[model samples]
Target: MTSQNSRQTLIIPALGGLYARLNDGVETLLRVIAGGFLAVHGSGKIVDPFGASEMVEGLGFYPGAFWSPLLAATEFFGGILIALGLLTRPAAFAGMIVLLVTVWFHWVTMGQGFSGAEKSLLWAAALAFFVVRGGNRHSIDARLGKAF
Candidate 1:
């Protein structure tokens, strides 16, 4: 076989195998990035717990007392869970909901449209993917042999 043919048959397949082997690690990395961002971004609210009350209420979620801490927990604790790959689906699903709400707030209430809401939209999509795919083999869920 020619050199090019050998490269295709050998190198390409080896690369493919490597990619498959690292797929779980890639998923874990993405989860860490997303979850870590959420945790850091929400850290302030977690400290106060009521910091987002007015904003959340302004978004029409009323009873700020309830939602304020709930949102805080979802971002903080939920982020921790996601990063640890423990109960990933539920955490990601909750994060998805929070991000969607932010998307609406930015797009509709703030009149920022897609430009302002783009980050939340992307975060929501990432959370949604985790919600569906669950934790990969490198995750705690996989170690426990249960995703839900």
Candidate 2:
């Protein structure tokens, strides 16, 4: 092969490999940021688990006394699990459900329109991505040889 062709062949493969690593790194970063934010945001709910009883009941979840702690645990602990890429898909799936509910609550219940529901919509999309993609090579799921 000519010098230029040889260089092209080498460079192309090198770039492909770099791109794969970069994609994995970006995925890991997204997981960490999303999960960490959920954990921190849920911290207040954990402290006063029953404080949301009225709001949750207003959302028609019913018996907020029962679901309050469950919501708190799902966000806080599930966020930790997702951040670690341990049972990531399940955690993300659960988070997605919570976010969807928030979307409905903000848009329909509060009549806040797209602007109010936008954050929950974005979070739901992120969680949905994780639900589909699971954890990448840099994740604990990958290390454990688990698909989900």
Candidate 3:
């Protein structure tokens, strides 16, 4: 090819346009899936006293075992925010932290594999995307004049 033709091809918009679309599709799916998973996990804590208390003790997140309600609330509300694509950057950051911790837990019990640790890795990647992208378009933040 000529130099000019090669330059045009290099800058062609179609050069992997399909792949970019696929990535967007995957991102949308992850937004839904991660949001739903977080909602359920938070709801579980609310419904199960034992589970909540056990989490407080097991995780030792609080200085003096101040109950798991704080974490539960973060999960539930953060999930909702992410689902609506409102305040997505902060929500995704928090969700990424949770996923990373989950990965550590799975690594201990489930060992290294696609069935366990890899799930957390993927969750981290998805959440990180939202954190960096801030929910692109068609999000609550965008519709409400607050997408950032």
Candidate 4:
């Protein structure tokens, strides 16, 4: 049987063997860290789910009462789902949307430009990655033999 390393080497004549072994672990690490931080960041907001009503309303998401709780849940619960690798794609997509809004808020609303929105842009990129990759083999989605 061809081992994973050997297959990797065949696919890429150099470096693949060395790096392929770490792919899943690194992906998992990134996912966990991103999701964990997102959850923590949203923890305070989730505590008072309606607190961001005015803020979301400012963003044009009518009915601040509805958007506020949704924003909180998307950050907190979606973060948990991402971290657990359950429904990873949808969760990451939600995160990406939130990050995109932050990017807009910082760059356009606050007029901070790239300097202020850089972090949110980076986060959006990471979540975008997860949205496309849909978790690695070590994820719950993989174990369940399905992903979305």
lDDT of 1 by residue, 11-34 (tens): 456576676567678888999888
lDDT, each prediction? 0.89, 0.87, 0.72, 0.91
Enumerate residue pairs that collide in model 4. Answer: none
Top candidate, metric lDDT: 4
Runs with alpha carbons beyond 4 Å of true place in candidate 3: 1-26, 48-50, 63-67, 108-115
lDDT of 3 at 133: 83
TM-score, cand. 2:
0.86
- Name the candidate that leads on TM-score: 4
lDDT of 2 by residue, 61-133 (tens): 8899988887898898888887888899999999999999999999999999899999999999998999998
- Regions of candidate 4 where Cα sits further than 4 Å from its true position: 1-15
Candidate 2 Cα errors over 4 Å, as ranges: 1-18
Candidate 1 Cα outliers beyond 4 Å, as residue runs = 1-14
Of the pair 1 and 2, which is ahead by lDDT? 1
TM-score of each: 0.88, 0.86, 0.70, 0.89
**Tens-place lDDT digits, model 3, residues 89-123:** 89988888878877876776447555778877987
lDDT against true structure, model 1? 0.89
> lDDT for model 3, on a 0 to 1 scale?
0.72
